[model samples]
Target: MIIAEQKPIQEIKAMIAGYQKVLIVGCDTCVTICMAGGRKEVGIIASCLRMALQIDRKKPQLIEDCIQRQCEWEFVDTLKDKVDGVDAILSSACGVGVQALAERFPNKPVYPALNTTFMGMPNEHGLWVENCRGCGNCGLGRFGGICPIARCSKGLLNGPCGGSQNGKCEVSKEMDCGWQLIYGRLKTLNQLDQLEDILLPKDWSTDRDKGQRKMFRGDVYYEQTV
Candidate 1:
């Protein structure tokens, strides 16, 4: 899932400082699951903004609304009524969601109230760790399901680096070596022989370097631009 965190209140206030009316939009998909830009968060931010504006004697009008998802056009289209007569929009969704709104409503000024952190999941209750970089090229099968490109500090495609010591990375004593985890996983599955295979240098052409990648679906007869 795409993990994000809400921006600080001061920064958000500054973003919409001159706006007399603003709409706070929330996304209910990935940002919601990460507890960042859900309906509840939208309400909280709206309330705080309202109070802050009131203290400044701005008499600002604030609207709070949450959609199923801000990334999809269908979900974003539902905000037609809520966005009416709004001077600006404060999106509590990730960066993608903010851009989606901006694309959908070109005339309206849209601002992000959250910072897109990473594509990862929560390890425990409140700890989220990045697992994937979405490099577009997937090579997890050869690495015992562990992604060296993301987990490894050096992003090594082959084996552990010389700096790895006793399953810990030299960059940080608390960080686990990505290759060490892969080795253990391969050993458990009796696939340690796969380690001897030499992996060529990664082809980064499949990554975001090409700019604005798209995936086409013949069955659906649609193209998804990411």
Candidate 2:
């Protein structure tokens, strides 16, 4: 999942202080799972903004709403009429969602209330750890399911660097060496032979840098939609 964390309240307040009317938009997808831009977090932020404005003698009108997703135009269209009177939009979604909202509502100033972190998975009750870099190419087949491009400190394509010590990354004691983990996992599965296969340089051009990557299925298309 794309993990993100909410921006500081002070920073968020500064972004929309000039506007008397603002919309606090939330996303119910990736951000929700990370507990950053979910419906509950949106309400808390809205209430806090109201209280802060009251204390500052600022009569700002704040409205809170959560959409199924802000990355898609269909979901953002739901706010067209509802956001008619708002001066600005404060998006609690990830960077992609913020940009999507901005693109959809070019006339309105859109502000991001969170910093998009990374592609990660939940490690514990409230902790999410980075996993993948979403590099245009994936080589998990040769690495025993561990992605060194993301987990490795140097994004190494080969085995662990000389810095690895006791199965831990040399960059930090807290981090486990990605290559080491791969070796151990491959050994456990009795597929250590896969380790001998060297990966070729990744073709990053095939990823997002090649320009917005997209996929379409003609089978799912309808004549009317076309």
Question: Which residue runs of candidate 1 sit more than 4 Å off their true CA positions?
Answer: 222-226
The TM-score between candidate 2 and the true structure equals: 0.92
Error of 2 at 216 (Å): 4.2
Candidate 1 has its poorest 10 consecutive residues by lDDT at: 217-226
Off by over 4 Å in 2: 221-226
* Candidate number with greatest lDDT: 1
| CA displacement after TM-score superposition, residue 95 of candidate 1 (Å) | 1.3
lDDT for 123 in candidate 1 is 88
Give the alpha carbon lDDT tens digit for every residue of 1-226 in model 1: 9999988887899889899889999998988888999999999898888887778877788888999989999999999877878999999999999999999988899999999999999988888889999999999999999999999999998899999999999999989999999999999999999999898899999999989989877898755576
lDDT of 1 at 175: 91
| lDDT for each residue of candidate 2 in 35-138, tens digit (9 for 90 to 100) | 99989999988888778778878889888999999999899999998678899999999999999989998999999999999999999989899999888678
**All models, RMSD in angstroms:** 2.5, 2.0
lDDT score of residue 41 within candidate 2: 94
Pick by TM-score: which candidate is best? 1
Steric clash pairs (candidate 2)? none
